[model samples]
Target chain A: MSNKVIEISNLGKQYRLGQVGTTTLSDDFKRWWYAFRGKEDPFLIIGDTNDRTKKGSSDYVWALKDINFSVNKGEVIGIIGKNGAGKSTLLKILSRTTAPTMGEYKIKGRIASLLEVGTGFHPDLTGRENVFLNGAILGMTKAEIRNKFDEIVDFSGVERYIDTPVKRYSSGMYVRLAFAVAAHLEPEILIVDEVLAVGDAEFQKKCLGKMKDVSGNGRTVLFVSHNMSAVNSLCTRCVYLKNGTVYSIGDTAKIVETYLSNESNAESCKVWDPSVAPGDSVARIISARVTDDKGLTIDHMLRDQKVGIEFEYEVLQEGHWPIPNLHVFNGSEEYAFVSVENELEYLSKKGKYRSVVWIPADLLNDGRYVFGLALTTMKPNVNVHFYAENVLQVEVIEDISKRNTSYNQRLPGVVRPQLNWETTLLSD
Target chain B: MADMKTEPDEEHWDLVVKPKSSLFTLNLAEVWAYKDLIMLMVKRDFTAIYKQTVLGPLWMFVQPLFTTAIYTFTFSTSAKLSTDGIPPILFYIMGQTFWNYFADCLNKTSGTFISNSAVFGKVYFPRLVMPFSVVISSLIKLGLQILLLMAFYLYYYFTTDQLHPQWTLALLPAYLLILGVFSLSLGILFSSFTTKYRDFTFLLTFAVQLLMFASCVVFPVSMYSEKVQNILMYNPVVSCMEAIKYSLTGHGLFSWYYLSFVLLVTFIFLIISVVIFNRTEKSFMDSV
Candidate 1:
C-alpha cells in the first residue's frame, strides 16, 4: 500500500463561459423541464472543452477535463500550470470550496488550503483575536488553537502588540502574523497557491522554511506556483498542466523543464512574443536556447561536453549584417568568452534566420554560467538592435568519475583546459 | 481499478468527496465539527460592530428601549390600544424585546449571502453557521434588552399593583426554546430564498414590518375580537410572546393548546428549512 491520501479519477469541471452561467433563465428552465422528464441535459450536450484561445461553438467549456492523479502520504507535489489552466479550479474542488461538475475525488485526510492568507480576518479584531478566528476558519478547533497560541505569537514576532488591532499593524507585520497563523495549520493534506508572493524576502524565506518543516513531518502538500525555482527546490514531483488537463506528471526537474520549455518566456529559452520582444519592428530575436551536443535544449551541461547556443530571429527589413553576439560569463561576473556571428556583409532577406554558435568542451571550469545575447548592426554607428542581459543560464559540471586527470585538487582561474602537461626529471 | 482494494484497509479517512450526497442526509457531524466557527462568528458579530461606536453594546438595550417608547406613544396613547390593563411601558417592553430579537435574526439572516460572500467564497465550512451565529448574537442582544424590561417590571410591581409573577414563569425556558427554533427555521427559510431571488430581500423588509402589526407585540390577544384572536393565536411568536408576558406580568394567555400548536409548526418549519438550507449550501456560491 502506498498510504494514499488522495485519489482523483476522470475528474472534470465544466464552467459556463461568461458571467451568465448555463444559458438564460428561460433556457435553464427548459433544461430543467427536460431533466424533470428524464431527458438528458440539453446544455451539457453542447458544451465543449475550455480553450479560450480559439472560439468554440458551445457556450459552456470544461475548465478541467478528464484529470486523473493520485497522491500518496507525505508527497510534496507541485501543481504548475499557466493562468486559466484550471489549477485554482482543481484546488477549489480539492478543498471542497466548490463542487465538481463531473466525476469525484476521494481525499482520505483533513484537507486545508492557503488559497489566501488571513481569510475572514475582521479588521476590528486584535491580532490575538484574528489568530484564533483565522485558525478556526481553517478548521482548527478552539483547543488546538489554544495549545499553539504562544508558539504562534512568538513566530509572528509581534508579541508586544498582539493585543493591538491588526489594522494598526504595518503591512509587513500583518503578513508575518497572517503567515504565522497559517503556518501553524498542520492538516494531513495542505494545498497552497501562490501565497508566498506576499511579504518581504526574509518573511518569504521564513514561510518556505516553515513549509519545509511541515512537509518534513510526512504531510502531503499540494503546491501551485509559477516560480519554477521554488518548485524545483521544494517539490519532489510536479504535475504539468496544459489547457485544463495534465500534460505530464513526473520528477520535479523533468516536469519543470517541460513546463518552462512550453512557456515563451522561459529562463533559458525564450520563444519570441511579438508584443514583448526586445527589438524594433525591423528585426527581433524570436527564440533563444542553450543546447547540448545532441541539439536538444538543456538547462545544465557537463563542463567536459561541448554545447550549442542557438538563436532564431526574424530580420524584417534585412540589411547591414545584423550579427547575433553571445557573451558567456561565469558566476563571479567574469567573462569566460565572447562570440559574434560572422555574417557576409549586408546580404540578407526579409525572412527568418537561424544562428548557431558552439562552445567547445573541456575549456571552461565547472560553474554556473549565463548567456548574455545581443543583436547588433556591424556597420555605421554599430547600433545595438537588441541587448538581452542574462538571457539564459546553464550549470556546467565536471564528473570526477569521467575524468582522466591525476590532479583532483582545486584549481584556479575561470577556465578549465585539457591542455598538454608533461614533466621530465632529467637530474634524477 | 486495483486501487479500490485500499478502501477496506483504511476505514478512518476523515473526508470523502463525491459528486453527490444523499438528499436526506443531514450530515450533522460536519455541522458539529464547525461549532467553534459558529461561536467565533457570534463573537465577531458582537465585538466587530461596536469597534468605533461610542455606546458600544449599550445600543443593544437602547434599540428595544426606544422601540417600546414608540409603541407606547403610537399604539397606547394614540391608538388607545389595550395592553390587558398592564402599564404601557412594561407591556410594550415585554413584547418588543422578544419580537425585535426574532425580527433582527430574520432580517440579518436574509442578507447572509450578500453580507458574507467574502467569507463564503474563500472557505468551506457548514454554511448554517452564519445564520446560526446571527441568531445567537441577536439572542444575546435580546438578553440585554430583557434586563431593561426587568427594571420596568420592578418599578411597576412596587409603584402599582399591575405586575405579578405567575406560575407560568417556570416555563420561560420552553418559551425561549420555541421562539428560538421557530425564528431560526423561518429565518433560514427566508435566507434560502434571498440567495436565489434577491427580490425577496426587499419584500422581506416591508413584509416583516407589516407582519408585526398582525402579531401580538404591542397589545395582548385578549383585547382583540375572538375571530381575530384565534387567527393571531396560530402564530408561534404570538403564543411565545404571550407566555413570556403572562409569566412576568401575569397578563395574556399561556395555554398548552397554543404551545403544542406552535411546537408542531416549528418542528415542520425546522425540517423544511434545514432541507432547503443544506441544498442551498451545495452551490449557493455559484449564483450568489
Candidate 2:
C-alpha cells in the first residue's frame, strides 16, 4: 500500500482586499452570472499576488496560489515563512476550518488539527468538563474520552482543581489542561500551528515530546512555527513558503539554513545619510558593518575564523562622554552577550569616530546572528543618545573540514566557545 | 508503473475536500459522524448559561411564567381580548410555551456564526452541530415550561370544566418537530446571511418579536378576520401555535392543509438554509 497520507495539488485561496462588504453587489452578480453560464469566475483572473505590503489595484488577492505538496505516513513537516506568507491559510485549508478557492486535496486517514489549543473550552465549565467538551470538539467520542480520562488528568497535573471552573484556574494550569486533552487525541494525522508557544519552556518541551511520541507511532504531523529551534528539533522535513508560494522543500537542516540566510535582510554594511541619520544633536550613527579579520566586509561569518563588528558615528558636540555598545542575539532571539567600549575616554573635541569589536572564532554557534548598536552616556543619569536595534545581521556557517569530531548534529546553545581543557593519564 | 503503483485508486482516499459542491450535497453522514460533538455542545449550552446564577435552571420556568403573566395582563385584563372561552392564564401560557420554544431556538441559533466564531475559526467539525445543538438544548427549557403549563392545566381542570384535550393531543410531538425544524431553518438562514452582512442579525430579533403577534401567541386566531387568518397561516409558526393550542384547550384553528403548508415550507427552507450554511462555513472565517 502507498504510505502517502495527504496529497494537495495546485491549491489556492483568494481573499478580498478590503472590508468584506467592499465588494459591490454588482461584482457578486457578475461572478454569479459568469458561473451560471458554465464559465469560469470573471474575478479569479484579476486578483493580484499576495503581498500585504504592496497596495495593488485589484480588490482580490490570492493568499495562496498554485501550491502542491504531499506528506507520507510518518514524516513530520515544518512550514516556515514570514508573517502573512500564507502559512496559516494553508493550515486552515488542510484543517477544513476553511476551504480553498480552487483545487483540492485528498487524505487517506483521520485528520485532526490544533490551529489553536483549547478551541472550544468554556470558561464557566470545570476543567474536567472542559476536557471532555474540548475532546469532543476535537472529534473524540465520549467513550474514547472516558477511556483516557484518567490519563488526561494525570498528564495535566491539575487533578486538584479538576472540578473547579477553568476561569478560576491560573493561566498556566489552563493551558496545561487544554493541551493535555489535545495530546491524548489519537488521530492518524495531526496538524499543529504554534500551540506550543504557550506555557513555560518545560511545558512546551513536554508537549513536543508527546508529539514526537505520536509521530513515533507512524502518524503524520504538520507543524507551523516561527521558532526555528523547535522546528529544527521536531520537523524532519521543511517546506519554506515565500510570498505565498512554496519556495523550497527538502531536508530540515538544508531548508532551515536557506530560510535563515534569506531572513537576514541586513547586509555587511548599512550607511545612512548624515542629514537623516538616527541620532540626536550630540551624536549620530553614520554606518554599521560586519567584517572578517582581514578587514574586508562580509555578509557571513565562518565558525573557525575571527569576525569584527564596527560602528561609525559622528559627534557634532563635545564633552558628552558617549559610550559605544553592541548587543548580539542569536537566531532564536536569545541574548548572546553585550560589549561596551570602556577603555576609550571622552573626546573633548567634535569629530567622527569608529569603534570595532572582534569576536573570537568558535565563540558563536553555527547559525544566524543580529547586532544592535547604541551610543549612551553613563554620567548624568545614564542618558542614551541613540539606539538602533537590528542594525546588522549575518549568518555563521560551520567549516566541516576544521571539525575535530565526526559528529554532524547541530550543537545547541547561544554561544559555543572553545574552552581550555586539561586531561592527564595519571594511571599510565 | 512503480509510481502508478504508489498512487492508489481514487476511491481509496478517505476524504476529498473541494472548493465548491452541489447545492444538494447535504452530507448528513458527516453530521451524524459528529453526533458526539453535537451532544457535547448541547451540554455546554445548557450548563454554561446557568453558571453563577441564584436559581440556575429554575430560570427556565421563571422566564415563561413571567411572560405569560404579562401577556395575560396586557391582552386579557386590560384589552379584554377573547381567549376563545379558555382561561386567559391557561391559554396564554399554552401559546407562549410553544411560541417561546420557537422564538428561543430562532434567536439563539441565528447568531451561531458570530457568537461561536472563536471556536469555529480554530477547529472543524460539522458546522451544523452548533445550530442543531442549540435546538436540542432549548428543548430542555421547552420541557420545563411545559410542566409549568401543565400545572395551570390541572388547576383549570379541577376548578372548571372547560378542558377537553382531544386525541389530537397525540400530535404534540409532531407539531414540536415542525416548530423545531422551522425555527432552526430560519435561524441558520439568518446566521449565514449575518456572517456577510450584519443587517440580518438586527432584522432577526425584531422580526421574531413581530412574528409572535402574527403567530397568535397572546390572542386567539379566531379574533382575526377570515382573510387575515388566511394570511397568518402562511407564517409557519402560526399553524404550529394554533395546532398546539387547539390540541390542549380545544379553542384554536387546526387544519391539515395549513399544517402541511407549514411542513412543506419548513422542509424546503431547511434544505436551502443547510446548504447555505455549509457553503458559508467553508469561507466565513475570511469574512467574519
Candidate 3:
C-alpha cells in the first residue's frame, strides 16, 4: 500500500462575499449554463492568482487557490497565518464541515476535527452524556467510546462533575471535557484549530502534550495556531499564509521566521503625516522610524547594539512644549522602557522640528520588540501632545559562541531584568 | 521515555500538505452505521421533553385526551354531528390521535433547521439524522396516544353489545404506513423550505391547526355533502385518518380508489421531499 494517507490536487474554494440570496440563485443558473455547455465557470475567470488580496469585480473570491499537496501517514503539520488568511477555511474544508468550491482530494482514512471546543456539546446535557454525543458526532462507534470512556473522563479531570450538566460547569471544565472526548476519538487523521488559546497555561501544556502523543501514535495531525512557539515546538513543518493565500510551506522554524520578519517589516517602519494620525491634538507625530546609528532601517538588531528612533513633527503653532519621549515595547504590547527628556524642555520656534531618541548598547535582551513615541506639551497638561502606539520593531540577538552562561536563562515579560544575584549558605 | 536515547527518524515524519476535497457525500449509509446515535438522539428527545415536568409522560396522553374531550363536546354535543353510528369518544379520539402524530412530525421537523441551527452550525454530522430522529421520537408519542385510543375502544366495546370490528383490522398497519410516509415527506419538505424563508416558521402552527379542522379530526367526513367529501378526500391525510377509523371501528368511509389516490400523492410528496432535502443539505450551512 502507498504510504500516503491523503492526496489533494489543484484545490480551490470560492466564496461569494455579499448578502446570500437572489444573487445565489442567479449565480447558480449561470453555473448551470456553463456546466451544460461543458465550459469553465464564467465567474471563476474574474479572480486572478497574482492579486488574490484584491476584491474581484464579481462578489466571488477564491479563499484558497490552487492549493495542492499530499500527506503521508503519521505527519503533523502546522498552519500559520495572520487573521483572515483562509486558515480556518482550509480546516473547515478538510474536516468536511464544508466543501471546496473546486478541485478534489482523496483520503485513505477517517478524519476527526476539533475545530472549536465544545462544538458538539449541548449545554443542557451532562458531561457524561455530552461525551457520548460528541464522540458519536466525531464518528466513533459506541464500543470505541465505551472502551475509552474512563480515559476520557480521567484526562478531563471532571470526574466529580461528569454527571452534572455542562451549562453548570465552568468554561474551563467544559473545554477540558470536550477536548478529552476529541483527543481520545482515535481517528486516523486529526485536525485542531487554535481553540487551546482559551485554556490556562497548564491545560494548554497538557493539550500540547496530548497532541504530541497523538501524532506519535502514527496518526496525521493538522494544527492551526498563531502561537509561533507552540507551532515551532509541536509541528514538523508549517505552512505560512498571508491574505488568504499560501506564502510559503516548509520548515516550521523557517516559515515562522519568515512570518515574523514580514510582520515586523509591515508594522515597524511607517511614514506618518498629520492627515494619517488619528487624534486631533496640539502636536501630531508626522513620522517615526527605527534605524541603527548608521541611519539604516533594521528590523533585527544585536542585543547590545544601540537602536535609534527618529521622530519628525510639524507644530501647529510656535510654543514651549515638553521634549519628545520614546517608549519601547515587547511582543506582548507591554511597555519595556520609557525614556523622557523632561529637563531639556524646548519650544517649537520654527515650523517643524526633528528629534531622535537613542537607546545605549547592552540595555536589552534577545527578543522582538516594538517602539512607541510621544511628543507631549509639559506646560498645560501631561497629555497635551501626540502619541504613537506600537509602530516600530527591534530584535535582540544573543551570541551563541559564549559558553559561560546557561542558555536556558529565564526571559520574562517585555524586558529582561539585568539584576545580579549571589548566593551564600549560612552555617550555625 | 521508554527509548529516551533512540534517534527518532525526523526525515520520514515531515508534514504533507494537500488540497481539500471538493465533493462531499453525506453518506446516509454511515448514518445507518451509527444507528446507535440515532437511538440516543431519540432517547434524549424522549427523556428530556418530560424529565423535569411533574406529570412526566402523562403530558403525552393529556394533549389528545383534552382535544378529544373538546371535539366530543363541540361536534358531538353542540353541533350534534353524525359519526356514522360509531361512539363520539372513539371517533374523536381516533381522529385526534392519528392526526396529532402527523402534525407533530410536521411541526417538529419543520423547525429542525431553525431550532437546532446553533448546534448544527458548530458540528459536522448527517444533518438528515436530526429530522429522522424527530420523526421517530414523535412516533413514540403517537404510540402512547394510540394506547389511549385503544383504552376508549375497549371501554366502548366491552360496555356495549356492538360486535368488534372484522378482520379488516389487519389493514390498520397499512393505514399507519401510509400516514408515516405522508408525514415524513411533508415534514422534510417544510424543513427544507424553512431553512431559508424563516417566515414559514411563524405560519406553521396556524397552518397545522387549520389543517386539523379541514382533515375531519373533529367530525366524520361522511357528515359533509358529496361535493365537500370529494374535496376533503383530496387531502391524503384525510384518507389516511378516515381509513384508520374505518379499520378500527367498522364505521365511516372506505374506498380503495381513495386509498390508492392517497398512496400516489404520498409517494410523490416523499420523492419531492427527498430531492429537496438532498439539494438543501449541500448549502444549508451557508444560508442557515
Candidate with best lDDT: 2
lDDT of 3 by residue, A57-126 (tens): 7666777787766677898889987777788878877776556667766676777788887765776778
Residue range with the least summed lDDT across 10 consecutive positions in model 1 chain A: A259-268
What range of 10 consecutive residues in model 2 chain B has the weakest lDDT sum? B1-10
Where in model 3 is the C-alpha error above 4 Å? A33-40, A47-55, A264-268, A280-283, A294-300, A312-360, A363-368, A373-387, A395-428, B1-26, B161-163, B199-206, B227-231, B264-268
Per-residue accuracy of model 2 over A150-179 as CA lDDT, tens digit each:
999999899999999999999999999999
Best by TM-score: 2
DockQ measured for candidate 2: 0.67
Which 10 successive residues of model 3 chain A have the least lDDT summed? A47-56
Most accurate candidate by DockQ: 2
Between candidates 2 and 3, the lDDT winner: 2
Q: Ranking under DockQ, best-scoring first? A: 2, 1, 3
Candidate 1, residue A302: the lDDT equals 87
**Each prediction's TM-score versus the true structure:** 0.81, 0.95, 0.85
* Clashing residue pairs in candidate 2 (N, C-alpha, C atoms within 3 angstroms): none
